[model samples]
Target: MTLSVTRTARGMVQPSGQTPTGTLHLSFIDRLPVLRCNARTLHVFRHGHEPAEIIREALSKALVPYYPLAGRLKESSQGELQIACTGEGLWFVQASADCSMDAVNYFDNIPMVHHEKLLPDLLTEVDDLDPLVLMQVTQFTCGGFVMGLIFCHSICDGLGAAQFLSAVGELARGLHHPSVAPVWCREALATTAPQVYATGKANPPPPLPFLPDYQLKHATMDITPDQINQLKHEFQESTGQTCSTFEIVAARMWSRRTKAINLEKDAKVTLVIFANARQLLHPPLPKGFYGNCFFPVTITVSSEKVSQASHAEVVKLIQESKSMLPIEFTKWINGNSVGDVDPFAPPLAYTTMFISEWGRLGFNQVDYGWGPPVHMIPIQGSSIIPVAIVGTPPKPKKGIRLMTWSVSGPHLQNFLEQMLNLT
Candidate 1:
């Protein structure tokens, strides 16, 4: 979709607040394209039908401390730095009351709703929308609701945005003061000078050709516990190998998608797995070091390998890739060693992607005084289908919940069938 830029009243505000002192640097990773979308839902208490005034009041108060950086958009002026605080940046709104609570809940329950439809619908209505970043609230008929969030990779990574959202939830509930305060580390991400580079090593791979005028498509499927188990058993039975929920599903879908696209056999596809390194690094990142801190752990293989390989072999390859990540990887990113690399280079084989929130450890306890959310559904992006595994909300009988954005309706249906077999 074409991204239109227009001036707005919100973008003119100056950064007059108590800005932090140090230069928070972001490493030179590609300006994570404006292509990223981090969507999610939150179910509220049954009786929590506070008037829209109260809700707005709560959000206003909670978001004040974050205002300085929250609504600001990025702008580059003559190769110099500039931040546009007016007319652009983060966007927030509340969905119309026409849709009932049950309808909203039903919508959330539908796995991986396609962004092609949902995102455009949201943008068309929210006029001042920035394809780069935005968030909104949708109320349901049952007095319950969902919070939809979207972030531009240029601002914060998925984990970074989650950190920001958790803080918002906490502030609304009157929890502790805004966490760790927001910091802009964009300067730290400047490209390195050629002299600083280590010579003799292989030069970074050529940058991936940008995909031209691509359109977004998304799909989702729901699977029962029994079905999931059966899929797992079938995969093991077929290949004598086991895969994590994401690996198994991802492998199958990637193979199918590449074939459908009519890709060449020797062409490699890249599976970019978003790894949450919050606790994996040394001296672990502070509880509030929000920004794009995630590093992609890629698994590259050709379409032929993916099509001919057994499920077990693919699973092993995925597992091996994950195992390769270490604390040093973060350091590598921070040090700019990763700069020589291209963020979009196509893989040697069919590529698919995975991101999981299995533990739900950090933000699950977000109690905004209204009580913790009974459910949370993340919106899927337009580029690549992402798999997110989150803990079911506290209220709905303790168990694991899986959510994913699909590339096609047929692919999603087939995936749900395989996942059902696992159960």
Candidate 2:
């Protein structure tokens, strides 16, 4: 169904109260060279009981605590990135759709909903939009709304973004403070440049572009819970080892994707596992750090192995990846890393497959009076890398949804056939 959405208003929203002023040093995890990208998401709500102003106002108040978000991204004298506490404010847009929630099936009909129209355009923005956070509230005729947001990847990961948004919801609901108070002590995760640049200098390398060029067809696949459980059982039976939901799912999907892409027989394929590292630290990061903390664990094997290996073999590789987090986390936070990644590090943008597990991020639980969001959508903006967003299904649904932007043409057809015929 074709839907028409009209932009109603736009402006910058400043913090409701005075915030600290000065530069906030970014941690090693926050300034990862391979993590320079934006995380765009879509949230579906079922009620219009809350006006757009309510969220806008709440966002202002939320900024009082999450002031780093309102600040602009700055580059230090050494080319490293940091947040300058200017508190310029958040960029907000108001929109309305001619159709209702039912018309788009509450955004569950991923292929039918015009996500681009539901989001704010970064190209035409004048709010010093160099990776600045942007939000859009699009109201539907049925008194429901869709909230779209764009967060700077360098500033926060998926879970961190959810925490911040939830804070905004708390304020909207008239809370004096967030249940999980905001914490900004990021220096604990900072790097010391143990290995200087090959030029023997102290500065880090220049950052890659935040977004990858989109040249592949984007599609979302919904896998039922039954299929997931069956796969899990099969994996354990085959490997004689019990694996978590992500291990088996990632293993199977990686194998299937490898076969679909039909890469060279001996090409080395890297599976990047974006594991949450909140608990792997020496003292563990606080519950409310709200910054980039996920450690991208990589497992590289021959394409032949990935395509031919039994689900057990691939899953074991994934298990190995996660098992190395403790040591890797130690090196990263202890400043043994070079620009947060060594030369031997697998180039994440070129990794064979990059999948972000969002099922546990609590993004769908953000509510500002209207019930929890029914769906959390991810917009694959101009991202150049081949990445997939694996997230929890909307309400009343029992399964996971995989939004893929890695393959196209016959590859997509093959992948779809495997998904629909999942046993």
What number of clashing residue pairs does each candidate have, in the order they appear? 43, 4
- For residue 202, model 2's alpha carbon misses the true position, in angstroms, by 14
Cα displacement (angstroms), candidate 2, residue 171, comes to: 1.5
Q: Can you give the TM-score per candidate against the true fold? A: 0.65, 0.89
List, residue by residue over 263-363, the lDDT tens digit for candidate 2: 88988888777788888876888878888777678787888988888778888888887888888767755656635546224564534578878888878
Rate residue 41 of model 2 by lDDT.
80
* Residue-level lDDT for 214 in candidate 1: 28
Candidate 1 yields a Cα-based lDDT of 0.48
Weakest 10 consecutive residues of candidate 2 by summed lDDT: 193-202
* Deviation of model 1 at 102, angstroms: 2.7
lDDT (tens digit, per residue) of candidate 1 on 264-319: 78876767766766565555656655555556677777878876766566667777
| Deviation from native of the Cα of residue 169 in model 1, angstroms | 2.4
Which one wins on lDDT?
Answer: 2
